[model samples]
Target: MSARQARIVHISIERNWREVYDFAAKPENMALWASGLGSGLEADGENWVAHGPLGSVRVKFAPENDFGVMDHIVTMASGLEVHNALRVVPNGDGAEVMFTLLRLPDVSEEQFEADFRWVLKDLNTLKKRLET
Candidate 1:
């Protein structure tokens, strides 16, 4: 299957990268944008764990400079597994977060596209909340 990509539109609130990074990195703040995720945020080493619809999702965060990237494995409510990477890049004004959803070989492209769109909408909501 082909990879699915989506972009979240956002404007910068505070120009300081450090402030942006810290706010975005906090797990509890995730619910401000995303749905069906972001509760029970916990951190161990460089990883984060959150209770999700599927049960639990473990995220491995890689942070550099003012940006952070994460690899996510989510077990969906339907028992399907999804793997994706999320990249948060500073827009030089604020930040633009991009999610690249990888479609597993056996996964249907339609499913991947639909889910990716949902994620983008959620992220956009999150951006507006944060920037406000």
Candidate 2:
């Protein structure tokens, strides 16, 4: 079965795909763009810990790969885990960065919309940072 609701928020950058991936895929670099991780991530064993409004969450990121896969799993303090699928792919001479935003069960419509806007805003911030 498919997710009841989802959105693919993306942005195009005038840089090489590998370059975009190299920077965007870094956990440290995410704080500069990702709002939810704005407090930044701290190293915790094989995973990273992000302290947010809901409390500290364990984040496990996909190992560095050449295929531009930057997926990661976020385990909330309550033990609920959310898988975030992020990627950077080639597009003409530039790169297209995409983030799959899934609306978890019981999330209000307004909150889901807010999440979509947030992801797009983050992606735009990424594009601005990488382009300059």
Candidate 3:
């Protein structure tokens, strides 16, 4: 697949960037929003893992507010490998979340679109969780 063929999703939150960032970036809080997705922070704070439909995916994060991006290598149960990047930025009133997906393994455009839709739903869930 072409590297240019990536999925990007954005969500605006109602809380300040700091609050949103701190809540979402922390491991324990992630479980609150990303329940059943196998997403959480490791006890050592060195890495985060989100279990995709495939296998246990892992990502290492820098210190908070480091402006560093987290990378994901998700191996689907069907043996498809997907690469993902997640970044959060401050926007007026709250924050903007950016998610990109690439290197889909045998994934069709329609499938990708569906994945993006699911991601948006997830983000909305997060927004509500944070705003309330």
Which candidate leads in lDDT? 2
Quality of model 3 by C-alpha lDDT: 0.66
Winner by TM-score between candidate 2 and candidate 1:
2
lDDT of each: 0.60, 0.90, 0.66
Model 2 residue 21 CA deviation (Å) reads 0.4
RMSD of each: 4.2, 1.3, 3.3
Per residue, candidate 2 scores C-alpha lDDT tens digits across 1-132 of 664688899889999999999998888988898878858999989999888665788899999999999999999977899999999999888999999999998899999999999889999999999999
Model 3 segments more than 4 A misplaced: 1-4, 39-45, 48-52, 66-83
Instruction: For candidate 2, list the clashing residue pairs, or say none.
Output: none
Model 1 clashing residue pairs (backbone): none
Better of 1 and 2 by lDDT: 2
Tens digits of per-residue lDDT for model 1, 61-93: 444444466446555545565666666666666
TM-score of 2: 0.94
lDDT of 1 at 52: 64
Error of 1 at 6 (Å): 9.3
